[model samples]
Target: MSDDGAHGLTIIAFIGSVFSPYYGWSRAQDPFDHCAMNVVLYGRPGRFAMTERKAGSLSRSQDHIAIGPSSMHWDGTELTVRIDERGAPVPRPIRGTIRLRPSGITAGPFHLDAGERHRWWPMAPASRVEVALTEPGLSWQGSGYFDTNDGDEPLSDAFTSWTWCRAELPDGAAILYDVNHRNGGGRSLSLRFGFDGARRDIRPPLPAALPPTGFWRMPRATRSDDGRSRVLQTFEDTPFYSRSLLASTLAGEPVRAVHESLSLGRFRNPLVQLMLPFKMPRPL
Candidate 1:
Protein backbone atom coordinates (compact mmCIF):
# COMPACT_ATOMS: atom_id res chain seq x y z
CA MET A 1 0.00 0.00 0.00
CA SER A 2 1.05 3.61 -0.49
CA ASP A 3 2.02 5.74 2.52
CA ASP A 4 -1.67 6.47 3.07
CA GLY A 5 -3.28 3.06 3.06
CA ALA A 6 -4.29 0.58 5.76
CA HIS A 7 -1.43 1.52 8.04
CA GLY A 8 -2.91 4.95 7.61
CA LEU A 9 -5.80 3.62 9.66
CA THR A 10 -3.43 3.17 12.56
CA ILE A 11 -2.90 6.91 12.58
CA ILE A 12 -6.59 7.57 12.03
CA ALA A 13 -7.47 5.36 14.99
CA PHE A 14 -4.85 7.12 17.04
CA ILE A 15 -6.24 10.50 16.03
CA GLY A 16 -9.78 9.44 16.89
CA SER A 17 -8.63 7.84 20.11
CA VAL A 18 -6.88 10.91 21.38
CA PHE A 19 -8.98 13.48 19.51
CA SER A 20 -10.28 15.07 22.67
CA PRO A 21 -7.02 15.15 24.61
CA TYR A 22 -4.71 16.55 21.95
CA TYR A 23 -7.18 19.24 20.93
CA GLY A 24 -7.84 20.12 24.57
CA TRP A 25 -11.28 18.54 24.51
CA SER A 26 -10.80 15.95 27.28
CA ARG A 27 -9.12 17.10 30.45
CA ALA A 28 -9.80 13.87 32.27
CA GLN A 29 -7.14 11.82 30.41
CA ASP A 30 -4.62 11.64 27.55
CA PRO A 31 -3.98 9.44 24.51
CA PHE A 32 -3.17 5.80 25.26
CA ASP A 33 0.41 4.66 24.71
CA HIS A 34 1.82 1.56 22.99
CA CYS A 35 4.87 0.04 21.31
CA ALA A 36 6.22 1.37 18.03
CA MET A 37 7.63 -1.19 15.64
CA ASN A 38 9.52 -0.39 12.46
CA VAL A 39 9.45 -2.87 9.60
CA VAL A 40 11.40 -1.18 6.83
CA LEU A 41 11.57 -2.77 3.39
CA TYR A 42 12.55 -1.67 -0.09
CA GLY A 43 13.15 -3.56 -3.34
CA ARG A 44 11.01 -4.86 -6.15
CA PRO A 45 7.57 -3.61 -5.27
CA GLY A 46 5.12 -6.05 -6.87
CA ARG A 47 2.34 -4.80 -4.63
CA PHE A 48 2.69 -4.85 -0.85
CA ALA A 49 0.14 -4.06 1.77
CA MET A 50 -0.73 -3.92 5.49
CA THR A 51 -4.40 -4.28 4.60
CA GLU A 52 -6.38 -5.41 1.58
CA ARG A 53 -8.38 -2.36 0.52
CA LYS A 54 -7.55 1.31 0.13
CA ALA A 55 -10.14 2.42 2.68
CA GLY A 56 -10.20 -0.27 5.33
CA SER A 57 -10.47 0.37 9.06
CA LEU A 58 -7.51 -0.13 11.38
CA SER A 59 -6.48 -3.71 11.97
CA ARG A 60 -7.22 -5.09 15.43
CA SER A 61 -4.59 -6.10 18.01
CA GLN A 62 -2.95 -9.55 17.68
CA ASP A 63 -2.83 -9.16 13.91
CA HIS A 64 0.57 -7.93 12.79
CA ILE A 65 0.82 -8.90 9.15
CA ALA A 66 2.68 -7.24 6.24
CA ILE A 67 3.33 -8.95 2.95
CA GLY A 68 5.43 -7.96 -0.03
CA PRO A 69 8.84 -8.84 -1.44
CA SER A 70 12.31 -9.14 0.15
CA SER A 71 13.73 -5.90 -1.15
CA MET A 72 14.64 -4.61 2.31
CA HIS A 73 18.22 -4.28 3.50
CA TRP A 74 19.53 -3.68 7.03
CA ASP A 75 23.12 -2.60 7.55
CA GLY A 76 22.63 -2.21 11.33
CA THR A 77 23.31 1.51 11.14
CA GLU A 78 20.62 2.30 8.55
CA LEU A 79 17.64 0.28 7.35
CA THR A 80 16.84 0.88 3.67
CA VAL A 81 13.79 0.12 1.49
CA ARG A 82 13.50 0.79 -2.23
CA ILE A 83 10.39 0.20 -4.32
CA ASP A 84 10.44 -0.02 -8.12
CA GLU A 85 7.02 -0.91 -9.46
CA ARG A 86 6.98 -0.06 -13.10
CA GLY A 87 6.51 -1.61 -16.54
CA ALA A 88 4.22 -4.54 -16.18
CA PRO A 89 0.92 -5.98 -17.43
CA VAL A 90 -0.66 -5.62 -14.01
CA PRO A 91 0.09 -3.15 -11.16
CA ARG A 92 3.74 -2.69 -12.08
CA PRO A 93 6.51 -4.21 -9.97
CA ILE A 94 7.93 -2.13 -7.08
CA ARG A 95 11.61 -1.83 -6.25
CA GLY A 96 12.72 0.46 -3.44
CA THR A 97 14.69 0.51 -0.16
CA ILE A 98 14.49 2.26 3.26
CA ARG A 99 17.60 3.28 5.16
CA LEU A 100 17.54 3.93 8.93
CA ARG A 101 20.25 4.95 11.36
CA PRO A 102 20.53 5.58 15.07
CA SER A 103 20.45 9.24 14.16
CA GLY A 104 17.69 9.23 11.44
CA ILE A 105 16.31 7.65 8.25
CA THR A 106 16.85 8.16 4.46
CA ALA A 107 13.77 7.11 2.47
CA GLY A 108 14.48 7.81 -1.14
CA PRO A 109 15.42 9.72 -4.18
CA PHE A 110 14.50 6.22 -5.41
CA HIS A 111 12.15 7.18 -8.20
CA LEU A 112 8.44 6.37 -8.39
CA ASP A 113 7.01 7.21 -11.84
CA ALA A 114 10.15 7.74 -13.82
CA GLY A 115 9.20 7.49 -17.55
CA GLU A 116 5.74 6.18 -18.16
CA ARG A 117 7.18 2.83 -17.13
CA HIS A 118 4.28 1.85 -14.88
CA ARG A 119 0.58 1.33 -15.13
CA TRP A 120 -0.02 3.92 -12.38
CA TRP A 121 1.54 6.74 -10.43
CA PRO A 122 0.78 8.41 -7.15
CA MET A 123 -2.39 10.50 -7.18
CA ALA A 124 0.13 13.27 -6.72
CA PRO A 125 3.38 12.64 -8.60
CA ALA A 126 5.46 15.45 -7.15
CA SER A 127 5.92 14.49 -3.51
CA ARG A 128 9.23 14.53 -1.67
CA VAL A 129 10.51 14.05 1.91
CA GLU A 130 13.90 14.42 3.59
CA VAL A 131 14.49 13.79 7.33
CA ALA A 132 17.55 14.11 9.53
CA LEU A 133 17.63 12.29 12.87
CA THR A 134 19.48 14.42 15.38
CA GLU A 135 19.09 11.93 18.27
CA PRO A 136 18.23 8.49 16.97
CA GLY A 137 14.69 7.47 17.89
CA LEU A 138 14.21 10.31 20.33
CA SER A 139 14.22 13.44 18.14
CA TRP A 140 14.66 14.81 14.63
CA GLN A 141 13.90 17.71 12.26
CA GLY A 142 13.33 17.91 8.49
CA SER A 143 11.47 19.36 5.49
CA GLY A 144 8.84 17.94 3.09
CA TYR A 145 7.84 18.83 -0.51
CA PHE A 146 4.56 18.20 -2.32
CA ASP A 147 3.17 19.06 -5.76
CA THR A 148 0.48 18.02 -8.23
CA ASN A 149 -1.02 18.84 -11.64
CA ASP A 150 -4.68 19.12 -12.56
CA GLY A 151 -5.98 20.32 -15.98
CA ASP A 152 -3.87 23.34 -16.88
CA GLU A 153 -3.61 24.04 -13.14
CA PRO A 154 -0.79 23.16 -10.78
CA LEU A 155 -1.25 22.61 -7.04
CA SER A 156 1.52 22.57 -4.49
CA ASP A 157 1.71 22.54 -0.68
CA ALA A 158 3.89 21.34 2.20
CA PHE A 159 3.33 20.23 5.81
CA THR A 160 4.90 18.35 8.70
CA SER A 161 4.05 16.01 11.60
CA TRP A 162 6.39 15.28 14.48
CA THR A 163 5.87 12.31 16.80
CA TRP A 164 7.56 11.02 19.94
CA CYS A 165 6.86 7.30 20.36
CA ARG A 166 8.17 5.43 23.41
CA ALA A 167 6.95 2.38 25.35
CA GLU A 168 7.91 0.97 28.78
CA LEU A 169 8.22 -2.78 29.16
CA PRO A 170 6.08 -3.48 32.20
CA ASP A 171 3.30 -0.91 31.68
CA GLY A 172 3.84 2.86 31.35
CA ALA A 173 4.08 4.54 27.91
CA ALA A 174 3.51 7.79 25.98
CA ILE A 175 3.24 9.32 22.45
CA LEU A 176 2.66 12.75 20.89
CA TYR A 177 1.79 14.15 17.43
CA ASP A 178 2.31 17.70 16.18
CA VAL A 179 0.55 18.32 12.86
CA ASN A 180 0.95 21.08 10.28
CA HIS A 181 -0.46 22.05 6.82
CA ARG A 182 -4.01 20.89 7.18
CA ASN A 183 -6.65 21.55 4.49
CA GLY A 184 -9.76 21.08 6.56
CA GLY A 185 -11.24 24.13 8.29
CA GLY A 186 -10.67 22.60 11.73
CA ARG A 187 -7.61 20.88 13.20
CA SER A 188 -7.76 17.54 15.06
CA LEU A 189 -5.74 15.10 17.19
CA SER A 190 -6.39 11.61 18.64
CA LEU A 191 -4.76 8.46 20.14
CA ARG A 192 -5.73 4.81 20.72
CA PHE A 193 -4.44 1.46 22.09
CA GLY A 194 -5.43 -2.17 21.50
CA PHE A 195 -4.37 -5.58 22.85
CA ASP A 196 -0.89 -6.62 21.72
CA GLY A 197 -0.70 -8.76 18.53
CA ALA A 198 -4.31 -8.01 17.74
CA ARG A 199 -5.37 -6.21 14.58
CA ARG A 200 -4.13 -2.59 14.50
CA ASP A 201 -7.74 -1.48 13.75
CA ILE A 202 -10.35 -0.67 16.39
CA ARG A 203 -11.47 2.45 18.22
CA PRO A 204 -9.49 3.10 21.37
CA PRO A 205 -11.26 3.88 24.62
CA LEU A 206 -12.07 7.56 25.10
CA PRO A 207 -11.82 9.56 28.32
CA ALA A 208 -9.74 6.69 29.56
CA ALA A 209 -9.75 6.26 33.35
CA LEU A 210 -6.14 5.08 33.44
CA PRO A 211 -3.61 7.28 35.20
CA PRO A 212 -0.43 8.44 33.45
CA THR A 213 2.87 8.62 35.32
CA GLY A 214 4.83 10.81 32.93
CA PHE A 215 4.62 14.49 32.05
CA TRP A 216 3.19 15.93 28.78
CA ARG A 217 3.69 19.50 27.68
CA MET A 218 3.37 21.52 24.48
CA PRO A 219 6.39 23.72 24.91
CA ARG A 220 6.28 25.31 21.43
CA ALA A 221 4.12 25.68 18.32
CA THR A 222 4.33 27.50 14.98
CA ARG A 223 2.60 27.79 11.62
CA SER A 224 4.22 27.42 8.21
CA ASP A 225 3.84 29.34 4.93
CA ASP A 226 1.38 26.90 3.37
CA GLY A 227 -1.14 27.34 6.16
CA ARG A 228 0.31 24.22 7.81
CA SER A 229 0.99 24.31 11.55
CA ARG A 230 3.29 22.46 13.94
CA VAL A 231 2.98 21.61 17.65
CA LEU A 232 5.70 20.41 19.98
CA GLN A 233 5.28 17.67 22.58
CA THR A 234 7.67 16.76 25.41
CA PHE A 235 7.23 13.79 27.72
CA GLU A 236 9.00 11.58 30.24
CA ASP A 237 7.82 8.25 31.75
CA THR A 238 9.71 5.76 33.86
CA PRO A 239 11.74 3.22 31.86
CA PHE A 240 10.67 4.86 28.57
CA TYR A 241 10.43 8.08 26.58
CA SER A 242 9.27 8.76 22.99
CA ARG A 243 9.45 11.61 20.45
CA SER A 244 8.10 11.94 16.88
CA LEU A 245 8.61 14.22 13.85
CA LEU A 246 5.85 14.59 11.25
CA ALA A 247 5.19 16.41 7.90
CA SER A 248 2.01 15.95 5.95
CA THR A 249 0.06 17.49 3.04
CA LEU A 250 -3.41 19.02 3.00
CA ALA A 251 -6.37 16.68 2.52
CA GLY A 252 -7.54 18.34 -0.70
CA GLU A 253 -7.19 17.77 -4.42
CA PRO A 254 -3.95 15.97 -5.30
CA VAL A 255 -3.00 14.89 -1.77
CA ARG A 256 0.72 14.92 -1.02
CA ALA A 257 3.14 14.75 1.96
CA VAL A 258 6.58 14.79 3.63
CA HIS A 259 6.80 13.33 7.16
CA GLU A 260 9.60 12.67 9.70
CA SER A 261 9.33 10.99 13.12
CA LEU A 262 10.96 8.99 15.94
CA SER A 263 9.70 6.86 18.88
CA LEU A 264 11.55 5.60 21.99
CA GLY A 265 10.27 2.78 24.26
CA ARG A 266 11.93 0.21 26.53
CA PHE A 267 9.27 -2.36 27.30
CA ARG A 268 7.59 -1.51 30.59
CA ASN A 269 4.35 -2.51 32.36
CA PRO A 270 1.96 -4.14 29.91
CA LEU A 271 -1.06 -2.92 31.86
CA VAL A 272 -0.38 0.66 30.78
CA GLN A 273 -0.73 -0.25 27.08
CA LEU A 274 -3.75 -1.61 25.25
CA MET A 275 -2.95 -5.32 25.05
CA LEU A 276 -5.17 -8.09 23.73
CA PRO A 277 -6.33 -11.10 25.73
CA PHE A 278 -3.57 -13.19 24.20
CA LYS A 279 -1.01 -10.81 25.65
CA MET A 280 -2.65 -10.63 29.06
CA PRO A 281 -1.26 -12.39 32.10
CA ARG A 282 -3.01 -15.60 33.15
CA PRO A 283 -5.08 -15.67 36.31
CA LEU A 284 -3.16 -16.99 39.25
Candidate 2:
Protein backbone atom coordinates (compact mmCIF):
# COMPACT_ATOMS: atom_id res chain seq x y z
CA MET A 1 0.00 0.00 0.00
CA SER A 2 2.00 2.97 -1.30
CA ASP A 3 0.49 6.17 0.08
CA ASP A 4 1.02 9.23 -2.12
CA GLY A 5 1.23 11.48 0.94
CA ALA A 6 4.18 9.78 2.59
CA HIS A 7 6.31 12.92 2.77
CA GLY A 8 4.07 15.52 1.16
CA LEU A 9 4.08 15.19 -2.65
CA THR A 10 4.06 12.11 -4.86
CA ILE A 11 7.06 12.13 -7.24
CA ILE A 12 9.76 13.34 -4.82
CA ALA A 13 8.54 11.29 -1.89
CA PHE A 14 8.13 8.17 -4.01
CA ILE A 15 11.62 8.44 -5.44
CA GLY A 16 13.21 9.28 -2.07
CA SER A 17 11.68 6.25 -0.37
CA VAL A 18 12.84 3.62 -2.89
CA PHE A 19 16.17 5.30 -3.59
CA SER A 20 18.06 6.87 -0.68
CA PRO A 21 18.79 10.66 -0.75
CA TYR A 22 16.02 11.37 -3.36
CA TYR A 23 17.20 14.38 -5.33
CA GLY A 24 20.37 16.04 -3.92
CA TRP A 25 20.84 16.57 -0.22
CA SER A 26 17.60 17.72 1.37
CA ARG A 27 17.34 19.33 4.79
CA ALA A 28 14.82 18.37 7.44
CA GLN A 29 13.29 21.84 7.21
CA ASP A 30 13.60 21.76 3.44
CA PRO A 31 12.51 18.29 2.45
CA PHE A 32 12.54 17.74 -1.32
CA ASP A 33 9.09 16.16 -0.98
CA HIS A 34 7.47 19.61 -0.74
CA CYS A 35 4.88 19.61 -3.56
CA ALA A 36 6.07 18.24 -6.88
CA MET A 37 4.28 16.82 -9.92
CA ASN A 38 5.77 15.25 -13.08
CA VAL A 39 3.93 15.52 -16.41
CA VAL A 40 5.02 14.17 -19.79
CA LEU A 41 3.77 14.38 -23.38
CA TYR A 42 4.25 11.70 -26.07
CA GLY A 43 5.59 13.85 -28.88
CA ARG A 44 7.50 13.02 -32.08
CA PRO A 45 10.88 14.25 -30.83
CA GLY A 46 10.49 12.20 -27.69
CA ARG A 47 8.64 12.11 -24.38
CA PHE A 48 8.76 15.56 -22.74
CA ALA A 49 7.71 15.98 -19.10
CA MET A 50 6.69 19.17 -17.32
CA THR A 51 7.34 18.79 -13.59
CA GLU A 52 6.31 21.43 -11.04
CA ARG A 53 8.43 21.52 -7.88
CA LYS A 54 7.50 23.59 -4.83
CA ALA A 55 10.04 23.03 -2.03
CA GLY A 56 9.18 25.83 0.33
CA SER A 57 7.29 25.71 3.64
CA LEU A 58 3.72 26.39 2.53
CA SER A 59 1.97 24.63 -0.31
CA ARG A 60 0.15 27.77 -1.45
CA SER A 61 3.47 29.29 -2.48
CA GLN A 62 4.10 26.22 -4.60
CA ASP A 63 5.64 27.15 -7.97
CA HIS A 64 4.40 25.63 -11.25
CA ILE A 65 6.02 24.19 -14.44
CA ALA A 66 3.63 23.65 -17.28
CA ILE A 67 3.40 23.60 -21.09
CA GLY A 68 0.87 26.31 -21.65
CA PRO A 69 -2.02 25.31 -23.87
CA SER A 70 -1.77 26.42 -27.51
CA SER A 71 -2.29 30.15 -27.49
CA MET A 72 -2.45 32.72 -30.38
CA HIS A 73 1.23 33.05 -31.25
CA TRP A 74 2.73 30.16 -29.29
CA ASP A 75 1.63 26.54 -29.48
CA GLY A 76 2.97 23.16 -28.28
CA THR A 77 6.53 23.88 -29.34
CA GLU A 78 6.57 26.70 -26.81
CA LEU A 79 6.64 25.49 -23.18
CA THR A 80 5.85 27.73 -20.22
CA VAL A 81 7.45 26.77 -16.88
CA ARG A 82 6.74 29.15 -14.00
CA ILE A 83 8.83 29.21 -10.82
CA ASP A 84 7.07 31.59 -8.52
CA GLU A 85 8.45 32.63 -5.12
CA ARG A 86 5.24 33.57 -3.39
CA GLY A 87 5.99 35.98 -0.58
CA ALA A 88 4.48 36.23 2.87
CA PRO A 89 0.75 36.80 3.52
CA VAL A 90 -0.95 36.49 0.12
CA PRO A 91 1.85 34.46 -1.52
CA ARG A 92 2.90 36.27 -4.69
CA PRO A 93 3.47 34.01 -7.65
CA ILE A 94 6.62 34.48 -9.77
CA ARG A 95 6.18 32.66 -13.05
CA GLY A 96 8.25 32.01 -16.22
CA THR A 97 8.18 30.39 -19.67
CA ILE A 98 10.51 28.50 -22.03
CA ARG A 99 10.57 28.43 -25.82
CA LEU A 100 12.01 25.32 -27.48
CA ARG A 101 12.66 24.33 -31.10
CA PRO A 102 12.27 20.97 -32.87
CA SER A 103 16.00 20.58 -33.42
CA GLY A 104 17.43 17.78 -31.28
CA ILE A 105 20.91 19.29 -31.11
CA THR A 106 20.20 22.84 -30.02
CA ALA A 107 19.47 24.47 -26.68
CA GLY A 108 16.24 26.34 -25.83
CA PRO A 109 15.61 29.82 -24.51
CA PHE A 110 14.03 30.18 -21.07
CA HIS A 111 12.24 33.29 -19.82
CA LEU A 112 11.22 33.81 -16.24
CA ASP A 113 8.25 36.06 -15.68
CA ALA A 114 9.58 36.47 -12.14
CA GLY A 115 12.53 34.41 -10.92
CA GLU A 116 15.71 33.59 -12.94
CA ARG A 117 15.76 33.18 -16.71
CA HIS A 118 18.44 31.65 -18.95
CA ARG A 119 19.01 29.43 -21.96
CA TRP A 120 19.77 25.74 -21.40
CA TRP A 121 21.80 23.88 -24.02
CA PRO A 122 21.34 20.26 -24.95
CA MET A 123 24.01 17.57 -24.33
CA ALA A 124 26.65 18.06 -26.99
CA PRO A 125 27.54 15.40 -29.58
CA ALA A 126 23.95 14.25 -29.89
CA SER A 127 23.03 10.63 -30.52
CA ARG A 128 20.25 9.01 -32.52
CA VAL A 129 17.05 8.82 -30.45
CA GLU A 130 14.48 6.21 -31.48
CA VAL A 131 11.01 6.11 -29.92
CA ALA A 132 8.04 3.81 -30.60
CA LEU A 133 4.51 3.78 -29.20
CA THR A 134 3.43 0.39 -27.89
CA GLU A 135 -0.34 0.20 -27.38
CA PRO A 136 -0.76 1.79 -23.93
CA GLY A 137 2.09 4.31 -24.45
CA LEU A 138 5.43 4.89 -26.11
CA SER A 139 8.96 3.46 -25.70
CA TRP A 140 12.18 5.40 -26.46
CA GLN A 141 15.99 4.91 -26.46
CA GLY A 142 18.83 7.38 -27.05
CA SER A 143 22.35 8.46 -26.03
CA GLY A 144 24.34 11.72 -25.92
CA TYR A 145 27.11 13.59 -24.04
CA PHE A 146 25.50 14.79 -20.85
CA ASP A 147 26.69 18.30 -19.82
CA THR A 148 28.54 18.64 -16.56
CA ASN A 149 29.88 21.62 -14.61
CA ASP A 150 32.55 19.78 -12.68
CA GLY A 151 33.15 21.06 -9.16
CA ASP A 152 35.93 23.50 -9.93
CA GLU A 153 35.08 26.20 -7.39
CA PRO A 154 32.24 28.37 -6.07
CA LEU A 155 31.71 30.10 -9.41
CA SER A 156 32.02 26.84 -11.32
CA ASP A 157 29.49 25.10 -9.10
CA ALA A 158 27.15 23.36 -11.55
CA PHE A 159 26.53 19.68 -12.12
CA THR A 160 24.71 18.29 -15.10
CA SER A 161 23.11 15.07 -13.82
CA TRP A 162 23.18 12.38 -16.48
CA THR A 163 21.06 9.23 -16.82
CA TRP A 164 18.43 7.25 -18.79
CA CYS A 165 14.79 6.25 -18.21
CA ARG A 166 12.79 3.28 -19.64
CA ALA A 167 9.08 3.06 -18.85
CA GLU A 168 6.86 -0.01 -19.20
CA LEU A 169 3.73 -0.14 -21.35
CA PRO A 170 0.17 0.31 -20.19
CA ASP A 171 -2.40 -2.54 -19.96
CA GLY A 172 0.33 -4.46 -18.11
CA ALA A 173 2.98 -5.73 -20.52
CA ALA A 174 5.55 -7.07 -18.00
CA ILE A 175 8.49 -5.31 -19.72
CA LEU A 176 9.84 -2.49 -17.56
CA TYR A 177 11.81 0.52 -18.83
CA ASP A 178 14.50 1.15 -16.23
CA VAL A 179 15.87 4.71 -15.68
CA ASN A 180 19.43 5.22 -14.47
CA HIS A 181 20.86 8.41 -12.98
CA ARG A 182 24.57 9.02 -12.33
CA ASN A 183 25.59 12.05 -10.28
CA GLY A 184 28.70 12.80 -8.25
CA GLY A 185 29.57 9.46 -6.65
CA GLY A 186 25.93 8.51 -6.06
CA ARG A 187 23.60 6.86 -8.56
CA SER A 188 19.84 6.17 -8.66
CA LEU A 189 17.92 3.57 -10.62
CA SER A 190 14.12 3.84 -10.41
CA LEU A 191 10.97 2.77 -12.30
CA ARG A 192 8.38 5.45 -13.04
CA PHE A 193 5.28 3.27 -13.39
CA GLY A 194 1.74 2.82 -12.06
CA PHE A 195 0.31 1.68 -8.73
CA ASP A 196 -0.47 -2.04 -8.71
CA GLY A 197 -4.17 -1.48 -7.85
CA ALA A 198 -3.34 -1.52 -4.14
CA ARG A 199 -4.14 2.03 -3.13
CA ARG A 200 -3.97 3.60 0.32
CA ASP A 201 -4.89 6.72 2.28
CA ILE A 202 -3.19 9.95 1.27
CA ARG A 203 -1.79 10.90 4.68
CA PRO A 204 1.30 10.64 6.91
CA PRO A 205 3.16 7.47 7.86
CA LEU A 206 2.26 6.24 4.41
CA PRO A 207 3.53 2.87 3.24
CA ALA A 208 4.96 2.14 -0.21
CA ALA A 209 6.80 -0.57 -2.13
CA LEU A 210 9.56 -0.24 -4.74
CA PRO A 211 9.05 -2.30 -7.87
CA PRO A 212 11.21 -5.41 -8.05
CA THR A 213 13.50 -6.45 -10.91
CA GLY A 214 15.34 -3.52 -12.53
CA PHE A 215 18.98 -3.17 -13.65
CA TRP A 216 21.32 -0.26 -14.41
CA ARG A 217 23.62 0.34 -17.39
CA MET A 218 26.83 2.37 -17.24
CA PRO A 219 27.92 4.43 -20.26
CA ARG A 220 31.32 5.87 -21.08
CA ALA A 221 31.83 8.96 -23.22
CA THR A 222 34.84 9.36 -25.51
CA ARG A 223 36.08 12.24 -27.65
CA SER A 224 37.70 12.03 -31.06
CA ASP A 225 40.45 14.24 -32.57
CA ASP A 226 37.68 16.15 -34.41
CA GLY A 227 36.14 17.22 -31.06
CA ARG A 228 33.09 14.94 -31.29
CA SER A 229 32.08 13.17 -28.07
CA ARG A 230 30.98 9.62 -28.69
CA VAL A 231 28.99 7.79 -26.05
CA LEU A 232 28.60 4.09 -25.44
CA GLN A 233 25.72 3.43 -23.04
CA THR A 234 24.35 0.04 -21.99
CA PHE A 235 20.95 -0.47 -20.26
CA GLU A 236 19.24 -3.73 -19.30
CA ASP A 237 15.45 -3.95 -19.70
CA THR A 238 13.90 -6.19 -17.05
CA PRO A 239 10.40 -7.68 -16.77
CA PHE A 240 8.45 -7.52 -13.55
CA TYR A 241 6.04 -10.43 -13.87
CA SER A 242 5.68 -12.26 -17.16
CA ARG A 243 4.05 -9.39 -19.09
CA SER A 244 2.74 -6.42 -17.03
CA LEU A 245 4.56 -3.19 -17.99
CA LEU A 246 3.32 0.38 -18.14
CA ALA A 247 1.80 2.05 -21.21
CA SER A 248 2.94 5.70 -21.28
CA THR A 249 4.72 8.11 -18.99
CA LEU A 250 2.63 9.96 -16.41
CA ALA A 251 1.75 13.64 -16.83
CA GLY A 252 2.05 16.47 -14.33
CA GLU A 253 4.43 19.49 -14.40
CA PRO A 254 7.89 19.44 -15.96
CA VAL A 255 10.85 19.25 -13.57
CA ARG A 256 14.22 18.30 -15.12
CA ALA A 257 15.34 17.15 -18.54
CA VAL A 258 15.57 13.36 -18.92
CA HIS A 259 16.82 11.06 -21.67
CA GLU A 260 15.32 7.59 -21.95
CA SER A 261 12.63 5.36 -23.44
CA LEU A 262 9.43 5.38 -21.36
CA SER A 263 6.17 3.44 -21.61
CA LEU A 264 3.11 5.29 -20.29
CA GLY A 265 0.98 3.07 -18.13
CA ARG A 266 -2.80 3.18 -17.57
CA PHE A 267 -3.93 6.35 -15.82
CA ARG A 268 -6.18 5.25 -12.96
CA ASN A 269 -7.61 8.47 -11.65
CA PRO A 270 -7.86 8.17 -7.88
CA LEU A 271 -10.04 11.25 -8.01
CA VAL A 272 -13.01 9.07 -8.99
CA GLN A 273 -12.67 7.18 -5.72
CA LEU A 274 -12.79 10.41 -3.73
CA MET A 275 -16.44 9.81 -2.82
CA LEU A 276 -16.04 6.08 -2.44
CA PRO A 277 -12.83 4.03 -2.31
CA PHE A 278 -9.77 6.34 -2.24
CA LYS A 279 -9.05 10.02 -1.56
CA MET A 280 -8.06 12.94 -3.80
CA PRO A 281 -4.37 14.03 -4.09
CA ARG A 282 -4.36 16.70 -1.40
CA PRO A 283 -4.94 20.13 -3.01
CA LEU A 284 -3.67 21.62 -6.28
For 1-284, candidate 2 gives per-residue lDDT tens digits of 01111111001111121111222324552333433322222232222222223344223212222222211122433222322222122232222222222222223322211122212222222222232233213343432121212111111122222223222223110111222221234223222222232212211111112232234222222111122221122122311111111122222211112223321110112321232111112223
Please state the error at residue 113 of candidate 1 in Å.
38
Candidate 2 clash figure, as a count? 32
**Candidates' TM-scores?**
0.20, 0.20
Ten-residue region with minimum lDDT total, candidate 2: 1-10
lDDT of 2: 0.23
Q: Where does the lowest 10-residue lDDT sum fall in candidate 1?
A: 6-15
lDDT scores of the candidates, listed in order: 0.23, 0.23
How well does candidate 1 score on lDDT at residue 4? 25
**lDDT of candidate 1 over 1-284, digit per residue (tens):** 13322111011112122111121223533222211112221222212221111112223333221222223344544334333322212223323332323232222122212221211111211112222222111122221111111111101122222222211111111112233332322222221112121112222212211122335321222222244533222122222222222231122111222222311122222432332222221122
TM-score of 1: 0.20
